[model samples]
Target chain A: MNLMLPDSGLLFWMTIIFAVVFFILAKFGFPVITGMVEKRTKRIDDAIGAAREAETRLRSLAQDQERIIAEAQAEHGRILKEAAEEREKMIVAAQEQARAEAGKILEEAREKIQEEKEAALRDIRREVAVLSVAIAEKVVRKELSTAEGQKEMVDRIFDELS
Target chain B: MRKMLVIFIALLTFMAHPVFASGSSEGEVDVAEMIFGHIGDSYGWHITEWNGHHVTIPLPCIVHSSTGWHVFMSSKIEHGHEYEGLFLAEDGRYADKIVEIGPDGSQVRPFDISITKNVASLMFGSALLLIIVLSCARWYRKHDALEKAPGGFAGLMEMMIMMVHDDLIKDSVGPDHRKYAPYLLTAFFFIFLNNLLGIVPFFPGGANLTGNIAVTMVLALFTFFAVNLFANKHYWKEIFWPDGPIFLKCPIPILQVIEILGMFTKPFSLMVRLFANIMAGHAMILGLVSVIFVAARIGPVIGGSMTLITMVFGVFMDCLELLVAFIQAYVFTMLSAVFIGLSRQGGHEEATHDN
Candidate 1:
């Protein structure tokens, strides 16, 4: 078909068509498609965010567990040190009591031995005095029997004694 | 009153200009000279006999009286006579007449009442507009139809629609693409039609619509309207008083003015790029075709070989011109979409980053 070239008349009609078509499309067709696309994008972003948050929470929990284990181990070490100190004190008190009993027994034995020594020394002194007296008596009797002169001297001694 | 003044001045200028006032008769003078200079003594319009490829107009004839001179034309023109006549230049600036003779002894006369350069361009543009809009309407009508439905014109339209959907709207502008697909598709078809028509060999379909600055300016203006109308407050805020450091927020008055100017300049550039490419191609073809004539004036032997070489070369350039037409159309469409996308972008970043 041989078409007529558009003059000012054609241009005016073209502008009308252009405006009407664009206006209709912009109002109806565009919004529906755009809305669907935006919804899909937001869903993806939400899923990604949730995954990241889960990963961070897992990491923090693992760190907390490690710290708790370290604290418990330190408490265990402190209790063991306190028990060892208590045992050492009990052993030192037992050794001191045994040493005091041994010293008292040794003092009693030495006092008994000093008493026996005193008694034995007294008995020896008495025996020596008695033997000296008996010897003096015998010597006087022998001298009287032997001579009349001796009897006269004895009478002089008795007058001196009275 | 002001508009009236302007129109009055333009009218005076048009009347004062000898060309338009002379009517169709005076304009035929150039057509006669162009014909005789090329063809030699074989064909005739009314007069039966030709003396050395020239036909002299009868004295006191409408063609001579009105034109202020008698026209002598030739018959056996080398190119063809089918495309021969006078036309009003697109901007009403210059007048041109050309004739061509095809090899089959046929003459192509370039006379059509309704096919001025601007009118021809407008028609091609409208065809493109019709194709895009009607096809889109058809697609919507058959939206719920089976995937393996019947195919013909609708199928061809589907290919173009998918290309715009995937390549242009989807890739360049991102997912909000659906919102502006119609505009982008319209621009691509409109520009493509005009560009292709501009490169056709003869009338009505031969004016470079996209190459004309006025056509491009109007296209840019459409884009400008779309951007501003659909734009969020964020887009305007960033341009006028952009979020930044306190110093930038203070806003140098001149800087704000220039920022606004940049919006207009961007579309202006789009117009110029398409216009220049099309104009350059046409001028190149005209120059090469002129060469054969220039060569023939020297002598017969050189002229024959030169004509053959220049015509072959000109054909090669015409093929390249076809490719350029599509490229320019795509570039203009892509740029317009990019601008719209830039305008419609969300405000989240501007608020959070102060940028």
Candidate 2:
């Protein structure tokens, strides 16, 4: 058989069947599968990008929390220091004022005690003057009756007063 | 068990074929004619013959003679019989073809377009490819390709599809490959499927469709058009006035002549390569099997050695033919891709400058 020369009939049918196959496949088969694969890749990429953004936000939030707590702790320490300093200053001022008040009261009490002692000395001196005058009257009457006895009494009283 | 049994019977037929062919007519076996007859296209699908009873599925025969049109089943002209003066020409220019007696008593061929064994197998192969590819495509439509991976036969088809579409065709066709993917995928699977089917020795197979020169010619023609039609200006320029030394272009245009010849020869080789490889494979297996009958003609001692030839060497050749089947299909598609890719290449000067 002459195998090299292509027959007209087989060649005709081959062309028709191959063309039909190509048309159907190009229209419905290939594009759908390839397109779906592309879409799936894109979705996966988008999902991964969103996950990365969320992780970054979470990490930043943790850092912010740490910074805020540090700041609050620093503020708390400063306030406590300030309050301690204030309390120390108040205590020192109160001690100084109490010492001054105690000194002032002591000075007033000393002054009052000097004035009461002076008044008490003046009343004792007056009572003593009155008692001496009554004794002198009685002695003068008795001495006139007896001149020698009165003279001796007056000498003894003058010696006692001296 | 049944399939093995069929094969054993077929082996018996192969042994009996020469005896039957010689005994009936010429008193000697023509081994070349016998091998060619098995591989060649026929109007009837010969299943088998047992006890002189020929069981065959007859196909329709259509022909247009110089006289008029005639259409009939091949069974109408069985066993050297004539239906409307048309019969299987036994010995003439168009031997084994549907022929009518010319006025000069010579055999004459008409314009024929019948459903031969090869054509029917072609239909079967193409239809099978359609079912497989379209079914996988439907599966892709039903489920998300990314979310749910294809399973079973669809999965197998996808793996093969990606290899052809992405790996082979894409790499070969360069960028703008998507435009060319459909033809390449179909051609690859078409050749592959037919090659596998051609190796089967039973019904629905055994029709060497790809081995037919006419069939491969049609396939090569498709690639031939795809390459030339879509090619850019630079591609044509390379073919007509190729980039070479001035001497090669001038002084009888040696390079230009070579380039032009290369274009046609590229596709021509594609057609011949597939046809010759498959045709040779079938012929080799037939030759190996026929050795047993040749030995049976001799005495028992050498007959045993000849049986050893068909047994050990024949099986080896069959296995090799199976490997050759896949390789030839792969080589055909790969070469087609390369040729088409070469035709679509841009200017090398521009390419070098960009780099």
Candidate 3:
């Protein structure tokens, strides 16, 4: 029970020892420990921040890639459609030009056939007239001994000329 | 668990051997004296009894008086026999203290600064604290890097220090925790180490430094000063002129008086709480061990059975004491943080209101 009482000697020593420990720990001990802990915490925070930034950047890059791909696909489709339309227009125009050239050649052939027919008719008419004159000369020579037939033939030719 | 078991077996062997060795020559055991002697501070370090011979390490007795400083080995006094005019007081109010024999045959109390058992233990604990903390601090300085993890003793200590900073100081002291963390960390580790060391019951462990009132008083005093000295004007105003009804202040100033008394009681409670808890723990364990000897007064068989049962219970109590040691240290530091935080609250409120 008497041990419960405080002793001056022990108290003095306790105070001295405790004060010395407090000063030493406060100055040399805690700062290093707490500083290190805080530094570790800050490092972790910075790492996390960097990771988050990288994640966002990756997301944006993916989005940009998707956009670019979509635009290229759309441009490819438009170019293909335009080429198909132009090819159809050129095919139609070539068909129309070939038909017009064939019609012009057929018209020129018809004019040449008409001119040759007219010439053939004129030649046939001339031959027929010569044959008729030769027959008439033979009939006159046999009939009246030539004087009366020659006078008739001369009269007919003069009438035709008038 | 295996270590605990070993300690238990060794302790049983030591206790059982002493009884049989002494045998028929044994005298009656003074249970009170035995228990108190185990728990109380002494001038020498008592190890254990062997072959009927008691082993103890005598410490130095240093005293100061009007005459001069008297220094000598405590063995010179021979456990109450006087030597060179100095003696241990055996009776009256100053019992167990070293007193000087005056020329007139009167007992004169000198200013004793002896390195008693408790003081030596305190010094031992201090040395350990210095060695561990300083070495860890040095190691941290050498391998200082923000991203690196701590290992071994430095890692263990860093975890504890971080706990004190984040949980105790930051939770209680708020933004100003940085200013108070160093002191709080020192107090927490110091008390914690001493508490753990006190439970050892052997060379480096038996000294009950934290159980001593003087030591607890000094610890509480540090908290008291830190709280009061750093308090702002608003804190003083709130204490002296609190917001309340006018009638309460006019007649007897009842509220003010209570507030004033509260300031002293807070630290006083801190002192008593730590001292009583530690001392009670040591006493309880000693009392339980003493029970076996008391039972031996009956018969051999019953005494033997009682010894086994008590020994088992003693082991359980020791484990509990280990837990209590940590609890007491934590409670002391947490309370200190709370008191300091409370003192700083007024200033924070005033600052916010002004803004």
Output the number of the DockQ-best candidate. Answer: 3
Cα lDDT tens digits for candidate 1, B1-355: 9844543443333222222212323323243333222221111222212332323222111112222332333332212322123211222211122222335644332322222335434655565656555655555455533324325765565556566656877777655677677677767777777777666543335454565555566677788887788776788986887655656446456656666888888887886787678767766765566565557567899989997897578667766777888888888888888888878776656656876
For each candidate in turn, the TM-score is: 0.48, 0.80, 0.87
Q: What lDDT tens digits, residue by residue, belong to model 2 across residues B1-355?
A: 9955655554555455445544433335567776787788889887765555666899988888767888898898888888887888887668788888788977789888988888889999889988888888999888867787788998888778777777788888887688887878788888989987887776788787888999999989998998889877688899888888998888789999998898889889999999999988888877876666667667788878888867777666656766887788778778888877887777556656777
Error of 3 at B50 (Å): 2.6
A162 Cα displacement, candidate 3 (Å)? 7.0
True contacts kept of each: 0.04, 0.71, 0.87
Those runs of model 3 whose alpha carbons end farther than 4 Å from true positions after fitting are A101-149, A158-162, B2-26, B80-83, B352-355
Cα lDDT of model 3 by residue, A1-162, tens digit: 466578899889999999999999889988878888898899999999999999999999999999999999999999999999999999998888888888888888888888888888878788777877777666666654777776877888899999
Which ranges of candidate 2 are over 4 A from the true structure? Answer: A41-162, B1-30, B103-105, B299-309, B347-355
Candidate 3: which docking quality band?
medium
**A95-140 per-residue lDDT for model 1 (tens digits):** 7877777777777777777777777776766776676666655665
In order, the Cα lDDT scores of the candidates are: 0.56, 0.81, 0.82
**RMSD (Å) per prediction:** 19.1, 5.4, 3.9
**Model 1 alpha-carbon drift over 4 Å, by segment:** A1-162, B1-116, B128-144, B149-153, B243-251, B348-355
TM (chain A) per model: 0.42, 0.66, 0.65
